[model samples]
Target chain A: MGKIRTRLGDGSFIELLEEEIYEDLVDGTQDAAQKGRIPPLSEDELRYLLDLYKSKARVVGVDEGHECCLSYDNMTSKIERAHISVSKFQQLQLFERALGADTLELAHIDYSYKQVKHVVIYDKPNMEQAVLLTIPPMLYGAMPNLGLYTYPDGPCPNPGDLLPQGKFDEAKEAYAQAIELAIKDMIFVGSELYEAGADGINFDTTGAAGDAEFYAALKAAETLKAKYPKMGIEMGMAGEFILGMHGEIEYEGVRLAGLYPHDQVKLAQKAGVTIFGPVVNTGTNESLPWNLARSVTFTKACSEASEIPLHANLGMGVGGVPLNIMPPLDALSRASKAHVELCRLDGL
Target chain B: MHAAHSIASGMGGMRTTGDLVARLQLNKGMRIEQAKQYVADKLKVPVTDLADSVTMGEMREDLNIGVVNEAPGVAKGIDAKFRIAELLDLDINCVDMFKDRVKP
Candidate 1:
């Protein structure tokens, strides 16, 4: 078993017992189910599963001996302690508040781990203070070029339209500048490039046009890689292709194999694409429970077969698990931790 | 930040009694249908009667099922009911009613 060290609220530290951790996992799963939350695996079930990978698993619970304290500086110095049995609904509310709506909606909550009895709170170098900054396309009016993209139907609109557009030359410059800024901010892990459709070279043997889009996206990724050589560059084929679109038959017959082609994975590995994943989830209904499970399973299989570091978008409504029912934040956190551990075990 | 947030934002602007019941946290009642029945039985009235009382335009409009802003007078009644319900592990409807009645 691996050991993890974490800081507590009172500037103290304590180690977490595996038994307590397992209990928390069970409670988290039950709470999530009661609250109608969507998670990859139930907390308890995941805990049991993690035990199978105990040799490779290392978890450190910070502030395990102290009370969970949340500091709110609104007039008075308020501290909210963790509840004994946090519900999934409460977790959803906290996630929405802490992570913000856009980020929460964009990212999927895989699993979380919590201390069963002790509330660990961090004050210095707060890990909970992290924020997700999205870098919009630089082109003045660059639409996401959704002509070949597939999206699910729902209240949430397709974000493809959020891209900027302008003269191709100007757009390239702007994209370059955006990449530079992203690198500076340490947020541009890789480029999420769009392809014309599943028929494009990125996903098929046709080697169609729209090389400009792919080139631009690829160049941005390369530039980032040159600066952060040790960092990863992930090339997202069009959302449609990654999603196995172009009809079910197309998906079953060719698109599926084409999307995760052995050659492309090898090519990306050679090209120094540190991590690559076909963006699987997009649109509103795309984050359904079944979709999430299928995507995780597919991504895991792809990673194992390709021997490459592949990550699913797992953000919000796209390629990530969707939560229809809200659970306690503690449960969600535990569930997320479990999910990440599972992914590691399954090589996702 | 205010109490009305529960009714306004939390409830997604739903005004019907069924909607309110469906959103409330109840132990035994997991689904909307079960919640409706639970509320009807607890209120000592038929499901239709309870629904009608909750759905009546005048009553629904006047009822403030929102989170309370002030505590002294407005939140006390709801707080008492909430504390009791929580202590006894009872249905949340009792607290909801107390809060609704206290809403001006």
Candidate 2:
């Protein structure tokens, strides 16, 4: 049987089409030619390709069914997965212990200039030090029964809901409590909270007066500060924010802002936010123009411009370095180490 | 002068009582009075049983009986003694008597 041929986004070719699948591709070739390509894949061919990628394209040995995936690559191992069910409190304890037990000192919890020493509790007597703890905003999203109210509608439940309401209030409360505990332990540094996407889920503010969502987020932040007077908040903005802010939109509510890091810094400062970052690891294979260096540069520039701290959510595994790679502990460690160094260099 | 000299020896470089109190908190069930006595006995003077103060003279004389001028060491010893006392359901002061007799 002839093998099936597939092309990846990187332009790399793979032979997955077998002779048995030749009949399925009979019409695929004509479709591809029509589209200015070799041949179009039939629905069956597409499904097969997706299945193959699902099996082979993922990080090897990391089970998706589990709450977390521990994977390894050429440089280091990492842990990544989604839909974790652990409580924020439990996750925080595990994270603290893991950082200490890993014994990698390159990572740190950044709160302005202070590098707080994380306590290692994982192995107890044989504890190791962790260089970094990659906590997702999912923790905040997972609190019990917290719903978010969206405009144009009412309140939405679950994270997938477009317009959410009550969850914001709950998120505020959780963050406030977390900040209080964190400050007492001197572990409060920065945070990675989920931001609403541009999709119609919440508000289409991405194109219109998107500042509305920012304003809402500000209210949430105000609530948090009222509880933890000493806590610092760092909001993680989606990459779409960058793309949306630069492009022209017709909505009166939505304003087009420059893409320069300084502009983001200014926007964050005006919002009374201390830290701002964008998504880095979205499973996209292509490396950005400057890779993570661009993010670092942008964050540093933004910080300097607005005198606000900035963090870069560098995607997992870029080039050979584990910038945003996951599931592999070693990779996570190295990436975290690199981030610490970058933060230090930027005087964060 | 002899009594003062003896007391001074007993009190040799004793740590502040507040420090001892802090150390006691680390031990699960140790009371402030017990912590004070532990410090006094280590100093080798008559255990005044005071919660607030353990005179330096008394601690200096007690230093001769293996009570080095180390706060951490003393604190550790106190912790261990407290743990054992808790485990055995024995009085903390009685543990000291057992230690003295058992050493030959």
Candidate 3:
């Protein structure tokens, strides 16, 4: 009988049971994949496609989001701590006291990074951070496992209470600050650690577009790109504005995810985002669905609108499903390959 | 850079073996012993702990978590359309669909 309270995209909060979240997330994903007429990736397929993806894709990467790094204490000594004001220091203290990054920093990958020639992205706590940063931290003390990132389950922590709608504007401002902090934190990792090893980044995962968070992510990616030209950036979002039969409508298909908003696609282009990934969302929240058709449509629409590479993904960048959790697929069944192929096709 | 096959907390040796096999299958010519050593050294455990000594099939059967094959053994109406209309990119009432059914 575990209970949790979290915020919705519509700026509301709901109390839900752990089993309910699992049923909706884990079970729902399996059921939706079945309904979408997609088969789970077999082990052999996963293996072969992973091979293909590694050899053929422009970029192959792994996400350790700052929490998962095994070598944190050492890395901490290595990282250049940013100068902090007393106020910001207090905020950091609050977060540090509750749900600090200490437990998650694995400290195992030091040699592996040296041995494996690949890209790695750490979090400025990343999206999980964004969720927390969206509201003033003082208002929301980390209640154990509110939403994502808490682990043994997810990255979510109890988001605490929603700030008044009057505070939504303040939340927006906080979003920009969150993006700034992520960039500032990464500057310490520098190109040699992250950029030299990695390609793009999981900029942010905001379910909707045209919000302060999405706009801030775009601005942040643009800011980082100016510093690291070779760095690619990817964002997670959903929508496809369906007006009527006059627009790009299916004759009789049921692709329920939101159509890509025109302005948001423009934002991606402006952000110089290397790719765009979908967060596997099918529950009746303000999120997208786990439908491949929707993925295809999103790629087509975003590519046409933005004229940039659009790579489809199973979940929000990191903490989202399928991306963070496994899809109903065997290890060898290359969900990564599907994304690479989608990027290739979308590029065309 | 894929973490798909990375060993996780509380995973058993059999599950670890499946990831190792998946890694080998993904990268041709990669040696299993080297991978086992890599994992073992990182986790500070012995190579035997990763189940490299066992068969993947045995690992597959013993795995506690779900996999592609472990997916719900049900399908949509067998005769249902396999793919959505490729061009159905119009803006629709996204939220309403969730009320009827959620699928992200």
Report i-RMS for every model: 22.4, 26.9, 19.2
* Per-residue lDDT of model 3, residues A1-348, tens digit only: 545443232223455554443333333234433434433333443343324322423333321110111001111112223333333323332222222221111111231211111223433223223322211111100001112222222222211222344454444344334434433433334233332222234433333322333433455556666776645444545333322211221211422123343335555656565544433332324221122322333343344454543433333222122232233222112233343333232211
lDDT: worst 10-residue window of model 1 chain A: A132-141
- Cα lDDT of model 3 by residue, B53-92, tens digit: 2343233333322111223542111000111001111111
**For residues B47-79, could you state the per-residue lDDT of candidate 2 as single tens digits?**
443221245424322432112233444433333
lDDT of 2 by residue, A181-283 (tens): 3233222211211111000000001112232233334344444445433233444443323433212321223343323334544554454443444333222
- Candidate 1 Cα outliers beyond 4 Å, as residue runs: A1-215, A219-266, A282-289, A306-308, A323-339, A345-348, B1-104
lDDT over C-alpha atoms for residue A64 of model 2: 14
The candidate scoring highest on DockQ is: 3
The superposed Cα distance between candidate 2 and the true structure at residue A305, in angstroms, equals 2.2
Model 1, span A1-348: residue lDDT tens:
444231121213334455544443344334333332224354454444335323232332111111110100110011122333543333323433332110111111110011100111221011111111111000000111222221242122223333343244443343333333322222221122111000001111111113222333444444545643433233434342332211121211232223432233444454445444433432232212223333433343444445444333333333332332222222222223333333431101
lDDT of 1: 0.29
Report lDDT (CA) for all predictions: 0.29, 0.29, 0.31
lDDT of 1 by residue, B13-87 (tens): 122233234222112212233444554555445555433424432333333332212223332223433443443
DockQ of 2: 0.01
Ranking by DockQ: 3, 2, 1
Predicted chain A of model 2: TM-score relative to the true chain A?
Answer: 0.38
